[model samples]
Target: MSAHTNPPAPFAGVNATWIYTLGSIVAVYVLLDLLIITDLLSSFADTRSRGMLALVLVSVAAAATRIRYCWFLRSDSGSGLPHIGWTIALFAPAVISWGIAFVIPEGSFFAAVQLWFSGVLFALVASRRLRWWLILLALVLTLIPILVSGMAGDRVELGERHPATVLITIYSLVLPIMLISSLWFWRVVARLDEARSLAAELAVTQERLRFAADLHDIQGHHLQVIALKAELVERTLATKPEYAAEQAGEIRLIAKEAMEETRSLVSGLRDVALRDELENASEVLTLSGAACTLEISSLPAGTDAQRVLAFVVREATTNILRHSNATEASIALAPARGGFELTVKNNGVGEEPGRDGGSGIAGLRARLADVGGTLTADAGRPGAAGHRSFALTAWVPEGGPQ
Candidate 1:
């Protein structure tokens, strides 16, 4: 059994009746064929000419059904056309067998036709990766009626015993096998697709981890230094009163700025600016007696573009002030590939705890990621040691991020 064949969904799921009706009819067609061959319904209909007529009628109906279903699939109106095709395929041999019935007698010629129909059914089931064995077994059972009917056909008179055609036999034996096989195959394919989807999600998670680690280190160091300076000044105030007071005031000011920076990182705001963050970082450093520098590239414009970039800049600046102790930080926003890229760099202490982005930073990343955007940070290349840099990139669709 190969595994892709799908038995198709229930009528409710497919929102269709044609396929189910056709499938029901097919069930009847095969059953009738079998009962007629076994002499159980000799009085119901003639096995020779009448059987041929019946098979022909069934084939025409099946073909018409399949054609209608194919149209349904092509249309945007509804679903289930595909399932109708499956039932039609199962009944196809009946139509062709009917044609053979007229051309040939109720003997070897008719038997060969039944054999051929069995082969067609087998091919269809196997093509969709259903269980081939059940269909193969059906073909074998069909031969029983063909062989028995042929031998008994000569012994009985038309006036008494009814004839059994080979086509009818094949339909009976093979129909059950096809239905069961198609159903089994349907389950296999669905499971495989689900597994593949899950694997892809797992891979994406690993990339997120790397991003989280780098952000924390850069932001933590800056925050720690500011905190330590403030505590020291607070204690010294009691001794060298004038100098202590001055240091205490400076410390109080730095503490206030750091608090503001922390708030920006925590807020769920959508401003993601490469330039603004750098500028803010420069301001904070200057106030703390550190120098600052800024560089910005042209940015693409669209609905809400400026606002989102602002948030990005805000968060980046917060990170720099909280972690890096460097005097200068550079920010840049430029067009890259097919979208815009934002970069923030600062010569901050290599790693610190609070600097590693928290849930707040992760939340900011999610904003872009949700819209198919990405955020990444690098600690700078050689000659750039003691510096941390972040590059945020997002590809806006034809219109823009929603």
Candidate 2:
């Protein structure tokens, strides 16, 4: 995967979810800032309104900073300690808000709550190694408002005693939960980053395995033929020079054929076409004792889409022959909305082939995906006579993917 590749979505693995999540979070925070700051201003009108406003605005800036930073860092490419500049931009508002919160007289409740929330945001954006210190700092900042309130003799009271004690008790319990929850979110993001890396690695590994298998399939038999011809030429070199020369020429031709096959495999253009695939599938199904029917529509030959669909046909046929005890098979190709669809179905699907519907199907799906196509295989619905069948379907866009 490239650096630009996006990490999958918010736990559902969708790619577009981040956009929605970001927008939603921003909207919610904006609403929360308006409500909470308005309430604080009305309740503590005699207090230092300037410091309270600064604290509220700074807290909002802190939350926005963390949101954007954390969102960017959600991708695999975005992991690591953020730059010094980003670190400053992310934490400066939180620190400034704490300073302002400590000085806002008789506003301990709003100020302390704001500090707690902003600290959580800072901890959330912090790297794992740095998060511990940041969480501790947030907790300490949570205490600073009460400490400053006590020293200023402006501590609020819920009953006969100062509410600062109750506030400390509440924050002491709440801050850890917030820290743990933030850490859990970070951990999940880290796992997603790791998953993306592993996925890219696995794709490379599968491609390598595919290349090895194709190389063997293309050249293995030709190599044996060349070997036999070479041995014959050596045996008759002195006794029959002309025969040996002919054998040598045969070996050369065999080698040339192998080279051409290798080239085809390398270029991903194997010797398969839609018409040829239809004929081959019918013959294979017949040999496997299945009655085969084909409903092919006319199409331009040698198109990229035709070649890909032809490969799909070949793979579906091979799967049927190897894995099923079908008595009847049908291959169909026709026009669909803005594209074409191919359906290959066979009766007597004993079991679903593999974890991912067999390697052939998996590989076909990947190839089809490259051309904006898709492959789906299912143990299809029960037929009229209660016979279960397997179906492999592929669809390609009209001109294929860019």
Candidate 3:
């Protein structure tokens, strides 16, 4: 793992979710406002009276959007998005609300001026992004119109720009849009940061699980075999001392080696080569009195051959031992059309391959899928009629992953 990778902190995760939700709201508001400004809502205005009412309805709907989204932001997930990004998420709803409010023709100037500050304050509270005074500066500067209009005239500046077309000039039109665009930019930054954080967490978790699986496969079966052998030795010792001594001595060596292997496994540096896993399976199957043949033609150079071989050999040998009382077991690895194939077949009545977890075939399928390979179990002939046979086959793509 890269040293730069970091899991999403609790607060960071929470912030990411909020950003996603609020960003969706802002995107919707902008789209709707753009549509409305295209005179789409004008169809609802049959007369001058209705036109005014329709505008009011649109403004109220836009305002209610802010309230609705604030309620959405009240979630209590422990995740914390980056402080900077979350700050942007928190502001997004209000920034969008300002965009919607600013574009519409307002019945009263007070509402138009008030809505911008309201959205900014809410964003500040939710994100704690900027100093209150910094955001308030915009409100204070924009409110200059209200103060000047109040002093010079009577209700003249209610919805009027200082100069008749001041709103069309370089100030209101250009600057407001530019500021709105900046808010959107911050929201995007927050989302990208959040995604990176989640990917890092996923990588860490997968690495941890990979290590655990390695340890389990290495030691679990070794311990099982040692336990079985120790039991057999104890039984023989009671019958004859010399024979029992021989068995005990053999058990001691195997046990000691297994212990050393156990230590090596836990340090997370161990890997079971494909060849070793196949050899281990062969030893296990031979001990169970089944005639076994291994036909392996190719190897993926530089990889642990035993580990790659283990998945097929282990599950196949296991089925031969437990489900089938077969007299013969055959394992083959050869080139296939796409990649390569490994198969194990037995000439005996085969139980369902994955009916139980103990069979390990299901686990085998999952393990192969990790490396973009596949495992399949089938019930059919063992190159002979009237004898039941089960086969486990796996194929891996030539490019290493599907």
Candidate 4:
């Protein structure tokens, strides 16, 4: 597998359900705030104006939620500040809502609080160096509106003597800190998940290196001995015919032993059970952020085809991890066309379908052909969302390899 240039984000392979759950919590919090703000504004404005303000507030909150979902939860959100256009997009609605709230009695406090909530989300996903700075700036900005409106005799109840003012002040101060703490905890979890995936990949790489070393040692020793014997036989053939014949016989015996030893090594490697491969593939894929499903009818007992199919499953898993950005995948094995068929499918085909047909596919095809089986790969049609699918199917006869 080729190395990726940019490392995946901490949350890149995290479970979608976890992300959505956290998002739902944030949404519910926003909804509650919206409810409180609506209640506070009820006695202050005409029906039409209040409705318009609610609509604007909902839009701003929804936009902030989208930013959290799409960027913050899904990718490397806090790596840096967003572009200038995004910055404008983030703050424009809040500013407009603040302006609208300033005209209405008892509305500015809620608006300031709403704006602070949005700012907290924005700062949560900002670069490390800028996150605290932006958060403090937002806090200061929030306090300004509250302090000015209160001192100006607006009905916000920010006076030193008012209990409501003290409560509001405390809430405003505490809300951002609470938000920052929760999101910080989430970031830490994402980092741990990413590290887990890296460790799995590292383990697989180490195993492959070890296997290669063992194969090299076995082949290197046997091949060197074979070469030396062949040279000795060639030199003796001219004057010592009997000795040459004996040497040639010894060479043949050595060749046979070498072939047998190599086969034994390979058989040991192929001893992996088909069921184990399926389970391992499912687990590894899940860790890498893809949901994997498996369906297997009664598997045949002790057959070469089972071993080959196990290999197919292993290879398919590797391809999905290395070659695609798949979110869902499945492995199914059943009886088909007077034989047993194994199908591996994923919804992660890239723009270029042909890229999916790499040397790995060719190698699988060759392996299947050796066992009188067939291997085929299809880059399926684009779905409604314009994402394509890839399926690899392998079929082997009922009895096993021919």
Candidate 5:
């Protein structure tokens, strides 16, 4: 299946929901660690060991940083190797916890679990490489400490009685399970991100193709009519000057109409009517899970201001869909202080991670300025419930600049 049509997978992207979920999980772990640390969970000496507490805190910190880095990585263009700093940031926690696990007073189930979790975390980050050999190498590295702890056991006992046996067995199961699970999780996320990007590019490509096809059809049809009319005019010119003149007039009319049609097609591609644009915007917003309300009293079919305002509606709708998780959106157009006002408003305005003010609004502003129009984008007045909204407002005079 194409990536765009693929069903949504769990943890597919580092969205707000994923961030909150991860934070909640970390909080729960922190709470559990605190209880264990204060001897509230259990009175066993090993359970409340200072070393275990240190390991738990470090592990949690490491996991949080690793997840944060992964989230940042997802926003990147997914080209070239990921920054070495992220690799260090992600790997450091796992390695440190490994050392702590090795030095625990004695091998315990909790230590085994911590070691396993660390291994899995490493795998999740490393899976970004999407290389099987590298993952295998990571698995080997994860196993080294477990091996070391096992071999460090006293030699007096051999076979089943060895301290290393239980440690080895626990890790033998833990390492593979965590490694496979993490590998699958990261792979799914990578694929989902790749699919999302490809889908966007494909949409643009298809639009370009459609535009090319339309241009070809329109030009070809007009050229054919012009060629046939020219032949008829040539045939009549010799026998009847009047007939030739009449044909010539027809030719001129046809040529003029064709030129106008071509220009109209080109302009219409860029500037649709405000009413049509509103309908399309509403459909797109609704498809994207936003409830849309359009409040334009009346939109003239072929006015200059309508064309410019239509472009604004198109751009603002695109930004709302691509950049926000808005649940509701509203667009309104009305007469204002000697001019027309167009505004697109939606909730869920916030800075996108890893992006500055996007080029859409900036480019829209420049376009409006070229036509003696003004564009304003800002946080809207807070609602009674103090909900934040982002609004894009534009004003164009009765007629566009002369």
Candidate 6:
């Protein structure tokens, strides 16, 4: 048999989830800034309001770029140098807003705080060495304008001693730390997912190697002895015909024994218990972030049908891992139609073409056929949320294959 290559990473959906969540957080922060900017725009002259609008737009672009970079980081697919233009865009809003505060000094406090939040959001994508520096710079830049405006005898109430100024300052200092901490936690999760994928692949490879070793042990000595006996038979045939015939008989017996042993080895390998398979499937799905439910009862052991059903469960687990973004899964085994029925279901049916018609399911159907069993797979209609479900069912006679 050809060796199995590692399947695609099972964490693509997980990564997409984290990416969407991160983007949502950034979007909320941007929306809050836009609200503040809208208020500021009404109080300012047209030219300054236009500048503020442009600043907000540039900041939005920078936020999008940050999310993109975070995705690239998580996927480990980024190449070439980081875009210089995005870094400039990220800082431009804060710089321009600070410039406005220096000139006009009216309503600079809120405007500076909102733009600083945008700067911090984008700075999260910066390199480790630069990220903190950029954030600190944002804090210093924001505070300077607010303090200068207050000290300049403006009634903006943004002085070093004002309650609002102190609170905003503390928030500006702490918010970046909080955002960075959250991103750091997310990065750790991505790494853990990567490690889990590697562990799973390694386990598969190790099992294959072990099986190969066992096969070699089973056949190696038998083949060697058969070769030696054949050589003896070839030599004795020229001089002692009766002895050669006896040796030939021994060779035939040895070959038969080898065939039986090989068959027994293969059967033993295939005879996985149904209950064990269900437990393993549940554990695997739960580890992959799916909630797995098992509704199974004890079945009699050492039956061909039981073995085949166990194999079906194993294959279904593999399919669910490789082909679906399932958040919930269930495996049910019960009596139906004078036999045992096994059903596996999941909510997140992916859009992989020919999923039900794929080679994996076809091979499964062939196996079930050998045991006088039937297998059916369906991608059920999507729900109101547009999330499709998939179900795989297998049925086998109680007395095993006829």
Global lDDT of model 4: 0.67
* lDDT, model 3, position 294: 75
**Model 2, range 1-402, lDDT digits (tens) per residue?**
556866555545433344444555445445545555565555446455576667667766776775566554343322655567876787677667666655665556455655565555555555557766776776776787767776777654421232234544554456546445544555566578679889999999988987875564345445544555677678889999999998788678768877887888889876645786677567657645789998888553437778778777767776675567789999988877678899999997775456568766787788789788888887866666666798899988887784
Stronger candidate by lDDT (4 vs 5): 4
**Candidate models: Cα lDDT each:** 0.50, 0.66, 0.55, 0.67, 0.59, 0.67
Clashing pairs in 4: none
Q: Kindly list the per-residue Cα lDDT of model 3 for residues 21-65, writing each as its tens digit.
A: 556545544543444333323433533554445454545455455
Q: Deviation in angstroms for 308 in model 5? A: 35
| Model 4, span 283-370: residue lDDT tens | 6667556789989996756467887787688677777766777899999999887788999999986754555377666766766777
Task: Put down candidate 5 lDDT per residue, 1-402, tens digits, no spaces.
Answer: 655676566644544445554454345434433432333123234467677666666656665664465444233222454577776776676667767656762433233344444444444444455544554665666566656655777223323333344444454455444444543454566578779899999999977764664454345434544565577678778898897787678668767866775687777643345786787677657645679888886554336677667767766776676567778998888888667888888886655322324565665566677677888877766565555688888987666664
If scored against the real structure, what TM-score would every candidate get?
Answer: 0.42, 0.44, 0.53, 0.54, 0.38, 0.54
Separate clash counts for every candidate: 29, 0, 18, 0, 0, 0
Off by over 4 Å in 3: 1-180, 239-268, 291-306, 318-327, 333-340, 347-350, 355-359, 366-373, 381-388, 396-402
Candidate 1, residues 1-402: lDDT per residue as tens digits?
A: 676877756654332343453465455545544444344233325544555555545544443443343322222222222464465564565445534433333433343335344344434334434436545654554455445545666423422344454445455456555544544444444456558778888877865654443344234534544665565567767776787677667667656755655566455332344344456555555655456555566766753454445556656666555555666666667776566666666666465334426554565576566555566655544235644544333333323553
* Candidate 5 Cα outliers beyond 4 Å, as residue runs: 1-115, 127-218, 227-239, 256-402
Full-model lDDT, candidate 3: 0.55
Considering summed lDDT, which 10 consecutive residues are worst modelled in model 1? 72-81
lDDT of 2: 0.66
Compared with the true structure, the alpha-carbon lDDT of candidate 1 equals 0.50
Give the clashing residue pairs of candidate 5, or none.
none
C-alpha displacement of 57 in model 4, angstroms? 5.8
